[model samples]
Structure formats: C-alpha cells, structure tokens
Target: MKLAGLTIAYWCVLVMALVPMGCAWLAKAGQLGKPRRQGGFDNHNPRAWLARQTDWRARANAAQDNTFEALPFFIGAVVIAHQLGAVQMRVDVLAFLFVVLRLLYVMMYVADLATARSAVWALALLVNIAILFV
Candidate 1:
C-alpha cells in the first residue's frame, strides 16, 4: 500500500537510511561530553576516548558499530525487494520486523544480554533476507 503514491517499503528504506544517523548520535552519547583536555569527548582523538568507555556506554558504542554493520545488508535487501516487485505488504512487514528486531537487539546489547542480543541479531538478519527473497 502506498500513501501519496510512495510504497510503504520505501518508507522503511528511508528509515533504514536515517538509522545510521541515530547510531552516530548514540556513539557521541557514549563520550559523555567531557573536555578533550580531560581525556573525554575529544574531537581530534574521538575513537581513543570512545575506546575507554565502560558499562552501558561501552555497550552502546558497540551497539552503534553493530548497527552500522547491519545497515548495508538491510538497505540492500529492502531495495532489492522493491526492484523485484515483491509483494508490498510482505516487503513492508519484513522491513518493519527488521527495524523492530534491531531496536530490541540494541537494547539487549546495552543490557549486556549476550545471548538475547545475538538471538535478536540473528532474527533481524533473517528478516532482511526474507525481505530480499519475498
């Protein structure tokens, strides 16, 4: 189904594109806004500071990295679904499922639930594959 003649699947594509921005923001959040002189939130040496993150902040950073890693496949799957003229409803559902699974994955990562997070990550990968095939 389309609103304003735009397939629902494309909306998911838009969300997928915007997701990287959220990941980038979350990466910055891990820095906690300390001055560069104090060894935190350094512009010139950001990765080094982020490398020192611990607890949930550290997990959040990892989640951001994982999120970025997932994006290319997810976006490609959605685009391929559209190109193949897959059923819009199925494509949209799978795309939406991928997004939900990713959100859960991120939360599980931050909570340090390794088993659950990995499970959710696997599920999201499956969802992306389904979108591509369907």
Candidate 2:
C-alpha cells in the first residue's frame, strides 16, 4: 500500500512525461504570440510548424525531442532499480535529482544556452546511470 500513491521513482516517471508536454506548450504559446505567424498553430502538422521556427520556440521543440529521447533510459533505470531492490531512499534521491536536472535542462534550452543545457543533460543522464548501479 505504501507504493500505491507516493513512490518517488514513479512520480519521477510522471514528471518526465510532463516535461515534454510543458516544452510543447511553450512552443505552441510562443508560436501563437508571433506577430506574423505564417501558419497559426498547425495542430495538423505541428512538427512542420515547429521546423519553421528558429528561436526559443524551436529550441523548445528540440528540448521536447531530447526529453522524449531520454525517457526510455530513465524509465528503464527506475524500473530496474525498483525491481532489483535497490535502496529506496537512494533511488528516490537520484530520481529527484534527475528530475531537477532535467527541469534545468529545459530552462537552459529555452534560454538558448546550448552548453549549459548539455551540461544539465549530462548530469541528468548520470543520475539515471547512478540509479542503476548504486
């Protein structure tokens, strides 16, 4: 019953999913705010719409892509740690760190800081790897 609603690693997975949604929302909002949007929020072809962007909105789209790409590894690490009886407290802490670093990664991406964003991404990946080994 303790794992029903408050597992930290599970919450980390939920947050991981939500991160990309937030990026997409930022891109959509950014697109809608453009003074001369050639195409207004192309729900039917959003990737094409985003490809036409070249600023923060584009960065947001790219960040969303990176977030999605990172999910499988993070999810697998969490699941393996949980299944193999890794220390819950350690797993929870690493999961939380990964979430924090990933959020920072998104912020750095949207801010157009490529080097810092990569650093955050590396840190988040390290956290996931650590969760697996430690």
Candidate 3:
C-alpha cells in the first residue's frame, strides 16, 4: 500500500520523541539508578551504588543525543525521497524499518548490550542510506 510523506514524517517524529520518554521512564522506575552491592561497598543505597558503578546520566544523555542525531537524516530522507519521486511503498518500508530499528536500538542501549545494539544501529543506518539513494 502507498504511504504519504507527511505520514512518514509524523511517524519519524513520534519515534524520535519516544526515546527520551523511555529514558525518563527508566529513571523514574529506578531502573537507571544504582544497583545493590555486597558488604564493603562504599555506597549504601543501591541507587547511589549504581550511580558510582556507571555514568548512567551520561548514557541517558547520549541516548537523547542519539535521538536528536537521527533527526537530520530522518528529515533528509523524507525530503530526498519526496523530491526524487520515490514510490510510496518504498519510502514507507524504509520509514517503518528505520523507526522500528531505532526503537529497538534505544531499548538495547538502555539494557547495555553494545554488540547487538550496534548491529541494529547499523541496520538503521543502511536503511537511511537506502532511502537516500532510492
């Protein structure tokens, strides 16, 4: 089925906007906080301990930047596709993959799996490239 440029743009916007929301959810849920430690640890609370274990705030900030990082490419892809007179099905398919893969990337990042997340990120990058060339 054919998809509209406006529709794809809206979907991209929605996906990008959700990244920070997920991060905020994690922080609010205490998932981003410190982890529990055995005796002899300096920090008492798990949150504080986890904070010392890793710079989660920095990670979250990076995720935010990643989301923003996607914006230009996403917008450029749509604009290029529209200008190049690409088929709606082709554009839609790329758009769908880009959005889904990005969401998965964000989730994997939050979970701290670098290898798999990088693969997903690469896939999304390829999709963007495809859109630009198509």
> Which candidate leads the pack in lDDT?
2
TM-score per candidate, chains pooled: 0.86, 0.90, 0.68
Ranking by lDDT: 2, 1, 3
Root-mean-square deviation of Cα positions for candidate 1 versus the true structure, in angstroms: 2.0
**Could you give candidate 3's per-residue lDDT for residues 21-108 as a string of tens digits?**
6654544344334343332223345345334434554455456568778878877887788788888678877878888898888777
In candidate 1, which residue pairs get closer than 3 Å at backbone N, Cα or C atoms, i.e. clash?
A: none
List, residue by residue over 58-109, the lDDT tens digit for candidate 2: 8998999999999999999989998998898999989989999999999999
Candidate 1's displacement at residue 70, Å, is 1.1
Ranking according to TM-score, highest score first: 2, 1, 3
Higher-ranked by TM-score: 1 or 2:
2
Residue 96 alpha-carbon offset, candidate 2, angstroms: 0.6
Cα RMSD of predicted structure 3: 6.4
Which portions of model 1 show Cα errors greater than 4 Å?
3-5, 30-32
List model 1 lDDT by residue over 1-134, tens digit each: 88778777777777767765675567667355777776557778767877886887678878888888888898888888889878889998888888888888888887889999999998888888898899
lDDT accuracy of residue 28 in candidate 1: 69
